[model samples]
Target: MDIKLSNKNLGLTPSVTLSIDAKAKEMKAKGINVIGFGVGEPDFNTPDNIRLKAINAIENKNLGYTPASGLPELKEVICKKLKKDNNLDYEKENIIVSNGAKHSLYNVFQAICNPGDEVIIPTPYWVSYPELVKMADATPVYIECSEENSFKMDTEVLKESITKNTKAIILNSPSNPTGSVYTKNELEEIAEIAVENNILVVSDEIYEKLIYDNFEHVSIASLNDEIKDLTIVVNGMSKAYAMTGWRIGYTASNKSIAKVMSNIQSHSTSNPNTIAQYASIEGIQGSQQFIEEMRLSFDERRKYMVDRINNIEGLSCIVPKGAFYIMMNITEFIGKEIKGKLIMNSVDFSELLLEKANVAIVPGKAFGSDNFMRISYANSMENIKEGLTRIEAFLQEKTE
Candidate 1:
């Protein structure tokens, strides 16, 4: 007997980031020295205090399942965090903690999207947004963000993308793949559009605490109460607290939306891990000294990668304001042949890099842009230096 899968998932491609990261790990396990820029997670250890809390919970054996919407105490604290850090007030009823920020986004799309509804996702976006939209049976409309514009969406372009079927739009600041931070002024304009168009704005702010230099992260929901009602703010402990494995993320939205998401999550995963949720409470409320130190270290790596990538032949990148990624432009090397392997696109470029240089990186095609590739700078300084060196050498050897 033959089993055919559902058509909805037939077109879904595996995540290129995870694919490359896993390959690198596999290669490393086989004794290969692979430097991978494919993983988007922080490479640091989870903060000691937060880990200690997890240990305490485990020791106490309080691992009972949490509420489908998450622990009441955690929701209350998340509300305070919103008001304190994001300048947005949300009650416990407006919050729903899910497995991760990714899950929160999936719920946001599922809660709002109907069949054939259009969700405007800007590119080069995080690789998962369009797929998640598709998974929700919604159409993902793309708006290309250019290097000239610092990889941010133009208000005019956004206006053009919205049509009658446009039900929602995604806004990611300290954005993945580009490290572009949306300014408050820019958000005000987008908020105006969203409010005028009655579009639900799903704002992903997972990298809010990983900023560098003087960049201030502005929550689009904080622009005004009107936009706040239409916005679902997604965040988690992953990036800021080096807690990727913790799998705790949350969404703050209107009560109705939160309720729908909670109901959906209730039947699916039931609740996020009980211990991780408890640990996240401490991750947010505990001392934030770890954030600054992580930021400084990331800033150092960011500076080094930007300067080094720019100096290398056939590669250039815009300096990112926040997040741990750099979108390295590989346009000049697109059609070159390296070791008789033709470089047709970013995927080809990445494959050759991985095979020849023993370095793993996700192709930008996975992120809705093919002229570039993303490099995560969350690796150690030594790894960053060696990885760039390997990339430079790999590209340098390209011939006709």
Candidate 2:
């Protein structure tokens, strides 16, 4: 029997990160030792204080459906945190909470994008952006950023990508797949371009609290009022708070935009989990000492992993300024034979690494870069050391 699937269902691709993670889990179940560097999640448990808050909420019978935009108290806390940390002012009415950062982003697209609209996305972006744009019935236009520019999209390229049909541009800092964070000057230039063109900017700052080495994250909307009116700031507690499983995220924007997002949420998931919202109030309002500790650990691992990969033959990596992933360029290994198997691109190279070294990493092709692969340093220091050592040995053996 043949089943007909709708175009919307047919066009979607399974998440590449999940696919690699599933393979790693299968290998582990078969009793093979596998070190997974493919997942984008943090390795730490959710903090004790936050967990206690959630437990208290359960005891208080806080499990019912809250407001679709979020609990009022939680929204107020979020607004206050925004003012204190990012120097941005917002009222509770300007915020809309969702299941996670991903949900907030998708809802934003659904609320704003009309069919046939174009969305400008910088390449080596988060894997879900282009697909989400497609799901919204919009086209995704890619602007390639080279390694010479630290993998950041220049203002000139952004300006050129805009057309009468372009509705929005998606920006991710402390970017996934590549850990490139934009500088204040670069952000100002991009904001200027967006203002000139009257295009919307959807800034994903989920990794906002993970910056290291004296680098500061300046919100693009905070540059000026005009930019603020045109930008939607998407953030969550996943990375910084190590609460990925809790799935609490929010967006702050112009009142009209927030209202529309809330309406969309009202029909769709109707509110995020009530306990998660209660816990998120604690997350945003609590002390950030845990975030700093995690950031320092990630910084050390980032430096160590980049140095180790660069020391291996036929592999090279640029030191990332923020975030916990290293995008390693493996162009030198393309077209080589690995154990009689043809290695042609990042995908082939990743499979060879898994088979030969028992190390799992995501291919850059998943993120729209062909000659590179992403290695996440969210594992323990010992695991990172062992994985890279195996990678180094695998390369050396192949070369010999």
lDDT of each: 0.93, 0.91
Worst window of 10 by summed lDDT in candidate 1: 391-400
TM-score of each: 0.98, 0.98
Q: Candidate 2 overall Cα lDDT vs. reference? A: 0.91
Per-residue lDDT over 1-400 for candidate 1, one digit per residue giving the tens place of the 0 to 100 score: 8999999999998998998888889889999999988989888899999999999999999899989989999999999999999889889999999999999999999999999899999999998999999999999999999999999998999999999999999999999989999988999999999999999999999999988779899999998889999999999999999999889999999999999999999999999999998899999899999999999999999999999999998899999999999999999978777889778999998988888999888899999899999999989999999999998887776642
Which stretches in model 2 have alpha-carbon errors above 4 Å? 1-3
- Compared with the true structure, model 1 gives a TM-score of 0.98
Q: Pick the candidate with the highest lDDT.
A: 1
Report the Cα lDDT for candidate 1: 0.93
